[model samples]
Target: MIDLMGYADRVWTGQEDLRPYFSGALREDGLLPVADGVWMWAATGNVYVFRTAGGLLLFDTGDRHTSRALHTAVRAVTQDPLHIAVFSHGHVDHVLGMDPFDQEAAERGLPRPEVIAHRHVPRRFERYVLTAGYNSAVNGRQFRAPGLKWPTVYRQPDTLYDQQLDLREADTQVLLRHGMGETDDATMAWLPDRRILCCGDFYAWNAPNAGNPQKVQRFVAEWSQALHWMAGLGAELLLPGHGVPIAGAERIRQTLLSSAALLDHLQQSVLELMNGGLTLDEVLHRVRVPAEMLSKPYLRPTYDEPEFIVRNLWRRYGGWYDGDPAALRPAPRAELAAEVAELAGGPQALARRALLLAKDGDLRLAGHLAEFAALAAAPGSAEHAEAHQARAQVMESLAADSPSFMAKSIYGWAASQSQAASRGEEPGKEEAGWAP
Candidate 1:
């Protein structure tokens, strides 16, 4: 039942009412209510605009249109040109929009703004392009899409630092701390003056994306430690790369503590499982968020589920080869699919059972049954509607369950598809694929 979406679980049960409380913002970037006049852009990435003794500083350049909003937000407060642009560890979403700033400055006949990043950022981009195929396929699974593409061109960073750098500008005294959590080149900028900590990807609104089930190695223990250190920052306001900002000293500390505890539990649990020599299935069966931990509103498992996090812990500590010998010399997937179909008494039988499960209030399991039914559907079989409806039911319930930014996007896409089927319309052009 838990294997329907291949990895999604029933961790969201009886949690429908929690959906509407999401404070996700629509715009890419805007102002942060903390520190009085500070502004931030909360995109699929995080961007911070800082006013210092020198001039304007842009931390993380968000996706393409970010500069327009940055300009607007900055002008409303100050008329200074951007003195420096910081790269929050160069994942494309955070840096691609630097061109806009460059263009804006060029129009005024100013210098191409200084772009600062850790020395490894440029190397990461290079690796991204060089291993585009690996990234595409891994991203496909992580995002739940079958086929996705990676970026073509990559750029090197201008101002690169090797270790830590202390930022002292405008009354803001910040410590730029580095680590290997979500990314090897990750950084968390701590401002002691305002007691504000700008945690890039190390600490986001969601569960740490450390175990993305896709790209490179994720340092789980280190990620947990980084959060531990962040909790000690005496931060009154916590601004992340994604989701709403968290303000208040106690709230900030509590959020970080809970996040760190969650990771520690996951890391510690997986290590115990490994020590006990438990299989993956056995380990997954035992994964649990301690009652006290899950009770925290900020620590809810809405966006990134705990199972994936567990598997990520397994990977980080044990390496990619999950030690399944058959996987090393496996039969073709199509052949395996046919064998499984035969064993299950054909696709029709699976579809029928799926419809039954769905009728019995097991929407998650129904999705798998419906998929197999759809895949096994004979061309021109009227069973198409049956499978489609099962998928729709699962999606609708999913929407009501969490409605996190990702969930809403998927729910909306699934709804549009169902509506199309009813109206005899062609597939939606913006068919929401996975978040690769």
Candidate 2:
């Protein structure tokens, strides 16, 4: 068995890299005891188990893919009936693993665990059902998993609270508070007696995922506020929705506050620029998280980048109008591409220039020029194939250069599409099979 606590201690002290913990590579197949009576099963999402005289309390069941495994692991540790399963949010990964638990209760003639979450969780489920197809496509593009399907059927919360709910299982006291962060329906569970905090996706080991480009709006300012709120609680043990458990009160405090500071800086900077009558583009270029903050191992932009966070802040405050009058009612992309190609001496010239720009490490400009060339050229023509090949190379370069998972996935998808176009095959036809 891997000494997860020792590993976590090494990671917290900077003696070990956080990648193993973050990727769940160090996770054992069974529940790992985190405290005297607290156990955590780390999967794609972390499932925390709290043993009490009443029963067992859980925070954020594992994802659908690991649901059965999680149940088996939890059962291996204890036969205690599940008392309450608290969903940190409505995201499928955090809430979909209750099926096996529910089955166990039925087979054993025990009462089903009461599901609890914020009031907005059901609304989030409804929205998921409404945008099932769009969610499927975007998630597929984000994770680089072709033909990924979004689950419309959700395990709704049996009990919902607006602000806070407190529960007592014998001597233990668990406080559930609603907060807006990565998702509006986020719940933070506090175990006062044990001085442990079950913070959902709010404090994932990587940078705060407040600006996932492919998802719904995230609350940046509110997210920082929630982090600050958690920091103030003086948690001795931090059990996050993902990653290994963090020990030590001061270490937990510093980690939470540092993450909070990064988000606060970005939010305030964006707000300051937005208040100054700057356009979204101008604000995006001006606002930046400090290099020192990004250097923090826990705040690295491995999943979501700071630039995307700035854009999300703008979207939250400035709405869809990016202050670009031309963008307010833009010309058809193909028409504009044709006009630009004509100015540049045809699609062939544009493609050659794009390849040249790519060679010079100007991937952003190269991508634009290559895409325009491909759009302007006649379909099935030699020029079209040349332009698409250029586009594919540029996109692949962009993917290679990106440190963020989201950016890399998107650029990779774009490259895949361009590769198909270059081969004279229909783009996105492979993806159509999974469309709702």
Candidate 3:
């Protein structure tokens, strides 16, 4: 067994939840045996293979880029054909690894593995097809990997279930239950005989990703309830999608429950502020989770920040108004910037003030002031150059301080744009997709 105490000390440094993983020795193709017959392949998204008497059962096949590596890893374990493959959700990373497995099976004169997932997966595929280029561009910026393209080819699932699915492979009983969490089509697997629960992205080592600023609306209430249900199962071994597995019944239960409590706290806190007629910005400042809960190893905000979660809750319960009349029908950004600059004397003055704000560590306010200066100043002007440089510095600082990879990606992209503008280049618009 890996030394838990030493591993924890190396992995958890109280700064970033996943910094240890990136700095550690785990390679993309490395496979770790979590149990006797179950093994996990670590990558952008993990793949868990269960070697049953009938054949191999796979849960969440990694990303498309890691397909060959995944195939090599699986072949190292067993040559038994893949009898069944289940998608944990409709995300691109979880579903695109099917082609490699299918290709290998075809070469061996074997039938393709039967794919299974929730009913909503087909719709998700349709949406991906509709917005293939758009999703590709957003993901490129999100991961800071320029020109990363999303494939138009999707392997549709053969078996689709609504809420619950039960299958018997040899003597192993596999139960698939639908839970609304990171995605609407999220599925969690439970093995009764082995007492192992494979939770997809629902339980990451970092904080819950339900509050992603760039993603769709996550079901927070249902997600919290799902955690409670998983905790009640009394599973001895818990396998998550992105991180190491947890052994021992009590440890698994507490980890799950603590994660759920964090969600519950965010949900309740957001609702309390919304019911009091506070605006989204006001509620963002007011709703706060306890430091103790935030300090939990599994509850660190390394992917989704709490503020974004509050905005999602507002979108669900309070609608799109955000309780701010100015945002209902805002003026054109350039026009507003010109007006603000005029009121502040000139664009040069605004640029100077922005630099001062950035120096004072008010990055958020500095960003706004710098944008106004940039928009108001003429192209190739000294004020325009100064404004862009200040904005770039502010964005870089924010990116460096952020623990969330998503936040760092966006802020880094913003910094790049500002830097380009300072060079007098017409920086292209940010193609980041709209969050639903």
Candidate 4:
């Protein structure tokens, strides 16, 4: 097994890069020791196992794809029946890995492990089932996996808590607290004796995922507050849902506090602009996180960017109008594009100008023009093909410039669509290079 602690030390001390951890490239396939009796199985999401005198305690199961492998890995380490399984939240990735564990218990004639989660978890699961198709479509686009299917079935928690719940198995005690962060049903598990904290997606080694564009509203203010609370816990070992484990009380505190500060800064800045009567577009352009904060390895924009967080804050505090009358009741995009194309002389002129802007490093503006050109041109015509080719190139540039995985996936997907259009082929049939 890789020396995870040594690697974490290197990463924390700035001797190693954090990209490998964020990308799960550094994660081992088997269970890795975390604390004295605690082992963590890292996949897209992490499954933390604590072997206690009573049996075993688990926090967050891996996703559907890795559930069986996770089960095998855990069993390899210990055949102890699972005592209690905690669902950190209702996200599919964190709650679907209990099947094999359940089967194991049955085989051993052990009682099914009790499942626990925040009270809102069931509601979130219900919402997922109701909007399965929509979730699948958005996730497909966001992850650059076309036609991806969202799972509708969910494992319901046997026990629910509104604020907090304490589970004691032998000498091990876990304090579960409900916190609003990436999801309303988020549960942070704290082991007071060992000073180990199992924070769900709340502190994934990236900029807090509080502003996912393709998802529902994330509570930025509440998320920041939760981080500040976790920072005060004096945790010595921090096992996150997504990245490598972090050790050292001071390092954990600094990481939590710094993440909180970033969220707090973005939340306050966006609110200030919203109160100042600025449009969403204006707020998006004006408000920015300090370069130094983003430069931090743990705070880098690997998944979600600060701009999306600003938008989430705006969406939370203000109406959807965005202070733009034109957008309040907008005309069809194609109509507007046709009008713009006419004013620009033609779709070909718009496409040519878009390519020039892209070459000049103005990809943001170029993307809009290229899209408009493609939309304005007659479908299947030579002009349409040319416009789509321009759009593909501009979108590729945009994707290349973005550091956030979410942004890159979206831009890359758009580029693929435009590339297909330019070649007179069906759009969305070819996945992007980054697609899993």
Model 1 pairs in collision:
29-41, 53-170
lDDT by candidate, in order shown: 0.65, 0.87, 0.82, 0.88
- Shift of residue 174 alpha carbon in model 3, Å: 0.7
Best by lDDT: 4
Tally clashing residue pairs in candidate 3.
0
* Model 2: lDDT of residue 91: 88
Q: Give the per-residue lDDT of model 3 (tens digit) for 89-139.
A: 989888888888899889999999999999999988988889887777777
Where does candidate 2 clash, by residue pair? none
**What 10-residue stretch in candidate 3 is worst by lDDT?**
427-436
User: In model 1, where do residues sit more than 4 Å from their true spots?
Assistant: 1-33, 42-44, 131-155, 168-172, 321-328, 361-368, 377-436
Total clashing pairs for each candidate: 2, 0, 0, 0
- Mind giving the per-residue lDDT tens digits that candidate 2 earns over 261-357? 9888998899898999999989988887778998988888998999999988888998999999999999988899999999999998999999999
In candidate 4, where is summed lDDT lowest over 10 consecutive residues?
Answer: 427-436
Q: lDDT (0-100) at residue 307 of candidate 4?
A: 93
Sort every candidate by lDDT, greatest first: 4, 2, 3, 1
